[model samples]
Target: MLSACFNIISVCLSLPSLSHLLCLSFSLFLAPSLSEGVSQMFGLVVSPLFPQGYPNNVLETWDIAVPPGYAIQLHLTHLDIENSENCEYDFLKVSVDGVVLSTLCGEKSFSELRSTVNPALYSTLGSMRLTFQSDFSNTERHTGFSAHYSAVDINECDDPYTGCSHDCSNYIGGFYCSCQPGYLLQEDNTTCAVNCSGEVFSSLLGSLSSPSYPGLYPENSACSYSLQVEEGFQLVLAFEGVFDIESGERGACVDSLRIRAGGREWGPYCGNVAPKDPVVTNSNHAEVLFNTDGYGANKGWKIKYTTKAKTCPDFVTVNSVLEPKRPVHQFKDQVRVTCNKGHEIVIGAKAKHHFDSWCQKNGVWSDIEICEPVDCGPPKEIDNAELKFINESSPTTYQSQIYYECEAPYYQINTDGKAQFTCEADGMWRSSDGKLDIPHCIPVCGRPSNPLESIQRIFGGKPAQLGNVPWQVFFQSPRGGGALISDRWVLTVAHMAQVDQPYIYMGFLDARNLGQGVKLEVEKMIIHPKYKRHLGDSSQYNYDNDIALVKLKGKVKMGPNVTPICLPQSEEEGQPELGKIGFISGWGRVKPRQTGKIPVSPVLLYAKIPVAKTQSCTDVKPTGPEIQKEKFVITDNMFCAGMPGVDSCQGDSGGGYAFQGEDSVFQLKGLVSWGIECGSYGFYTKVVNYLDWIRDTMAANED
Candidate 1:
């Protein structure tokens, strides 16, 4: 109805030439009833009905009222009155429920004006009043403003902007506040506050108690408390008094006290009996929540919280030398230590004593420590003789060396007058005799009263006893033999040295049981620079520089069965006089068949062969034409060692031809190089010719 009235009024005002009587008739029909005072459940308001211009000094008012639980919205559609910046002369003012909403004037128009009340005055009175006034003047006039007002249901819950603590409910022209079970709505009806006093606390030590503790707590009350401490300290919470809360099935608790710390949630404790022990946290922070239902509540809990410093057990000292040292103050720190040579940690003792040690949280090392050196007792004493210290420092540690001299009244030195012994890494003494027993200091060389065992003319040689020739070593894979000259070097012929997997066996004499000997792997091989093989032509092959040195992967521990032979001091020391008998030993065939093929020997055999002059070597019958041409070219680097029926055979190419020097110490004089059939003249590599080169090569490769 109000919209229809505004439409008629607009048409009437637009037609100013209309008769005054017609205008009057339309105004009487369209105007609101005077008895109702221009106020309705929903209505529209406009300026006074005048054709020319509104009468000067006029005042008009309209009141709009909507049902309860609704609000009025006014929208000004057309506005044209006077033109004044402040609307001082002719203006319209609007108020909702006696509270001024807006005042408009001049020729201005408005989109919408709502009935909003100050939050402090939260009332829902559903009425609004509009007043239009004009000063006494008849100059200019136009169609005044028209606005539509309607009562809309006030949906307080629909507008999220409405500030309500927990919940908002719309009522008749009003809204109210509501909260969850455990919270209370504040006086402002917007925010909520817990019923308890304290909410959060932070300190090293403190006490947390429910509201009105010692007495039963009020129903529908909840309290949350948070406690924090230093980063390294953990919070410990313990109940100090009787505790009780509502209990439910399956260990659930109503009106319970729950503690949360270290990312873990503890029990919702709610019984009369207190927990047996305090609850500790893995971190520095802890949060506790105390909730109560509307029913039974006991004298709530009083929990005492304190902080403890995180620490570990005391560190233990070790016996071995530590790299960074122990007693690490911080967690995750590491320490490393190593045992000295000849000293080692026992098996399974402290991670073998050479492992990385880490400091654990318990203030203890992750590894153990146990290091001990191999001990060889004091040097053995010789009877009827006094020992004179040559090294001046009596040494007994593993692999330590000691030199001594013996007084020669009744006892005589075995080799040179000066004797020495070594403490082996395996806790044994190696005497100068290359045996475990102490040197007897008996007659030099212990010359037999009668020559019982002759070195010459033995068709089949016997197996040498252990330690008889400690330097002799057998080569596997390409069966051959060599001599251990140093801990890391083996002297062999170039032919025997070229092996894919060169392995050396020492210590034991019986070649049948080579596995019982000390086995060593070869790391490097240095063959003579000029050594070469002439394919199938053995005579054309250069045997002059057949010597080669093999370096072992690791030093071989000197022992009774594994020892180094003395190297010649000079070329003269290594040169044997012509016709002087020398011993040659190997694990080769005792005798070769007439077919010239030799079988493998199981026992190490030795025989004495006279050294022959180069001219004599040429006189022997040559096996091939290549030998006849090479025999005359035999230089000083080559020598002959055998005659018919007595010789070193196949597999003895690298065996040692050693002779006891004037000093009574055996020296390597030759290396078996080649032979023209077994038991015939055999050529040997004169070791004296290449002694300098051998020494230089060893010194360069030493590690």
Candidate 2:
């Protein structure tokens, strides 16, 4: 209602207190142009009759609001009014959310006051109000004040006291708080908390207590705990803690506990003499409950429970469709489950849908069999090989036949039999004859183009024909030779490649011209680390771990005269080959050259020798410049291969000793490392021991 002096206004704001409700009537007055927001951006504000004589006894107010995320910024540019004691005669005031900013009277410019808290006032909650009053008697004419208000962005997110416990979002003049997906925002709209009614238990043995164990339980709470076990077991509850639940007169339960299970309900047991005996849940499932009144301070119940085998829940699978179903199967019954037609039972790696499953003495079925759709998926990918489907399949389910073939001229399936596999019902690829290894693509290697015919025919030592030993590396003179194990790698002894850049010659075999052969420049030389460490501070070097790989700067062109040798495929392949005859070829000096020219082998000479007896090899007194005075350690990593008339002599160091296996392919057995003399059963570093090292080094350094 409008009044002569003021408008009776009633405005209420919720203040944070015990009651949390507050209402205060503020005298509100809007003169012409005062109530206008001016715009959302600004609001024009001034006292009554600004810049002219003003009347008295006037108490008025103007309330301003801005958009969320922004606060109302009030700027007073001018101030001129009648002055009186304590500004009681006439005054203008600014406030926000019930907090007063300042009161002004008399004549004072916006800058006439201190820089702080005078010319401008801002609201924290995006709302601001002002009050103006005039005394009934004015001494003279005065222009009260001229001010403007606008929305200023309030960064609520930057304020730690904004009440957001998690994520906070701010917009033009306001802000809000939010929580993660699984959490619920509490009543305050700022806290994220998980709301759960009770707890769940799955263990075989445990105890449940109401809220706190020893202390008094919480007030005004209704909680439930759920327990579930395997279908055949019955849950048993035994109450054992202090029975102190609140109760009314005549021992009625004011606070109580209840149990519900298998269509049976237990008591609202209270006044707790503590249910002295145990309560049996005749079935497999159960739920325990504990409720309380608003007023209660008592230690609640504690239940120690155990499960016993009893009547079990019915069993049947939707997909498998086990037959002879029952609504309630007893633990004592020995009934068996059977699958319907078109489905066969599988037990591990076998097919026996029926008898594979059995009822155990513990009342639970062991190895419960199930029927499934026969599917083997796509056959596993075979390295270096592709497959051809032949059976009725796209081809990988039941009865799918697949044939594997190696990737062409460089590789072949290492089997005389058909390289085939079939997907059986057991979900595995099996051969027709439950034998033979899976199809693997092995390199077509170790085979020589120009054969040596027989090692015996060579007798003691002779020059190899151009392609007789295709895998031999022709390192001129006594520098050190190697075996071409791959297109770009050569295997040799570590001691021979002590120099950083060792050169390799392939294709042509000419010791006379030396550098005339095709020289393969070495890019990297990896010596056995153990062999390198054997070069410690000692008078003598043990050539025990003498093995190294040389990587050629470029791949060697394969032809009739240049090819790779095969490595030992299996772990024990070279072990049983103790007494086998092998060949070692090198361009070494049979005799020293005169006048600064060390004589290389006139041709690539190879020695036909048998692997000597270990006793005879280790029996001899060791000699040689490399062996020095140290005892020759004939470790298992070295083999003795040579007789009196046939041996890898001094200049044969680092040469590969190749053996023609039963497959008619040459596998490098060893490398000529050290010997007592030019003969004395030549000691070669066994190639088998370092097979993994060779393969790993080559694979890691591949281009």
Candidate 3:
């Protein structure tokens, strides 16, 4: 037994040497060129444009073995690629024994490909096999590759297609077999067969073989199949339409479709059937469909679309037939609860317009919504200048107020005839007589338009009186002013001329011949009672009483040549808003829109800026919390107007806001107050709101 064991050990010790001798002898004939220093060639066996790996191309496999503690070095070539057109290539791969090592993209110098190998790695590898596989497919020209070996042992497996589910048979240098389950091996096992279920399937997979797809469908190419399943199985299918070369329409007007399953058959449905709006799209491709219960018990059934009897095209294609499904309604029958009898429920709360939800007891309606009764403030008695409150019960909400005042000679008023009262709980206030009085009205100078016939000839024939017509005059200030009540009192915004320097030329028609015309220095210039020269908070759209009356030094002349325009009845009240047209004239700058250089025009030019709706002014402003809190308050007393692209400029301030009124008349509506930016929508004060106050002030001054 000992002797036999020794013999076996001796044979085992020599086995490795014997194997190396055999490998060397075999390589002698096959790799003679490599032994003579000819380098090996490595690269993509075929181009990568093919959708699948190379067609009808076989992989070349070579075996190699490196005993532990030893590494093999080999030179490789042909990896260098010059500028070649259509140069899309698969990766070049290297392997050790039967295991893959690495894959690289594009081409590299022969030195680089050879240097990619690590001596320590190759030394540890026991066996390897190099395969030149066509990783891409094409019907174009073929490219073959070869390898050179100086000294190496080839390690090939018994069954190259090992682990394959189907029959794996070993051949000379490689193995072959078909894939198992859900697939059938093609003539070349490299390609696998696909399995389709649930509906009629074709061998070509994605592509269909129906005839005349879009315009017409041939009966012979039409197909139908069935499936068997449990009581409630889902039926899913997807298809796409094919179009004709000429017409863009779909196959033979699909008049109707029907599906038969379980024991009953669904009716022949119209081609217009669709889950979401049945109209088809351009690409006409369908992806997935999953539906259950709608088709009853899942079983062998036919789904098809048919045309009207005796149509040009006979049968409809499967592409026209879509999978039908039932829709779900999330809300069934929901109810909402209302508040107690004394309280009312807002429309959005009790009867919601969207998302349909009901109200419960603890659910508060304040946040959601709540309806309230309409309440108008109590009536006030306008006695002279005092406003007396009769009823006071309702509460005030927004910027609600009952303005108060008294008529002429009453510097202060007594509310309720006893004391000047304040706003009451019911939103009412008691005033002296609801009006203020003026001291003495100063006469405003009118331009000489018609002058006397002899005076007109000397002043170049021009009309003097033309219903508050603006006249050319010389004033120290850049801006101009207007007449408020009569030819004596002139209404000019306070900012135009400073308090220290004030002068007026009463009869100056044109600035060119200024010294030749009648001139007068301002004697007593009375600014508006509440006129703050600075823009002030009024720039915030709040003009807290901006009316002034100027008293001239003396009343020089009067007639058709010079007469003050009559003031409208209610000077401070808002007028009935009927589309009003008026003109604005000024001497600040003829073309203020032009650059720094201004036109030296003493003559006022005017443009008709139509009054715009208040809503339009608010729409153009920027929206945000800052703008809202800073300047976006729309008060009841304020009136806004302007055309979007056009507006008054610097020279137009303190000018008249004229509009046609009752009895075929042109009257001054309001006065220009203050504006931030020039040539932007301008806002004006409503003259009608303060008519009583204006008349009272004028009368008080006159006294």
Q: Report lDDT (CA) for all predictions.
A: 0.69, 0.72, 0.39
Q: Count the backbone clashes (under 3 Å) in each candidate.
A: 3, 13, 61
Write candidate 3's Cα lDDT for 1-703 as tens digits: 0000111111223355465432211111212211122212211122222223233344444444434323334334434221233333433455765455654434565566566632322413444444444434544443332223333332323335344434565543345566556555555554443332236432212333222233333211123334322221223322334211111136332322233442344433323223222211111122221221111111112222211111111111111211121131111212332322222333643432122232222121113334232222343444434543333343322123444354433122333333343333222343344322311222222222332222211211122223235332335555464543454455655555445555544333455565644454444555556544555453344444555556666543443323444456653324736345554444454333444565644653444566667665555553233344245445544456555444455555555666544443346566665443345455565566656666766677663
Query: What C-alpha RMSD separates each model from the true structure?
Result: 21.7, 29.1, 33.9
Global CA lDDT computed for model 3:
0.39
Task: Kindly indicate the candidate among 2 and 3 with the higher lDDT.
Answer: 2
- Say which candidate scores most in TM-score: 2
Q: How well does model 2 score by local distance difference test?
A: 0.72
lDDT of 1 at 386: 64
Per-residue alpha-carbon lDDT of model 1 for 1-703, expressed as tens digits? 2322443332324456755534232343354542355334556566777434566787887766666677666666666777677777887777766787666765543432222212221224566777888888847657676666666668778878787757788885678878877668867777655577456677889898887678877665667787877665668889887676767765677778888887899877887777888998756778888877756757887999887654333433434556665353345666676765566666753224376666564445677665666557677776435654443454676667765454433235665543677776566877656677566444222121121244445543556766667778898767788888776788999888876678679877677787788998889988999876446634454566888998999877665566666667787777867888777778876755444565777877777788886655566665545445444346677888776677887787788888776655677888988765566668888888888998899889877
The TM-scores of all predictions, comma-separated, are 0.36, 0.37, 0.30
Q: Rank the candidates by TM-score, best first.
A: 2, 1, 3
Model 3 error, position 244 (Å):
99
Write model 2 residue lDDT over 486-594, tens digit each, in one string: 7778888887777765656876666666564567888998998788545655544477889989899886666677778888887788552667788888766564223
How many clashes would you count in candidate 1? Answer: 3
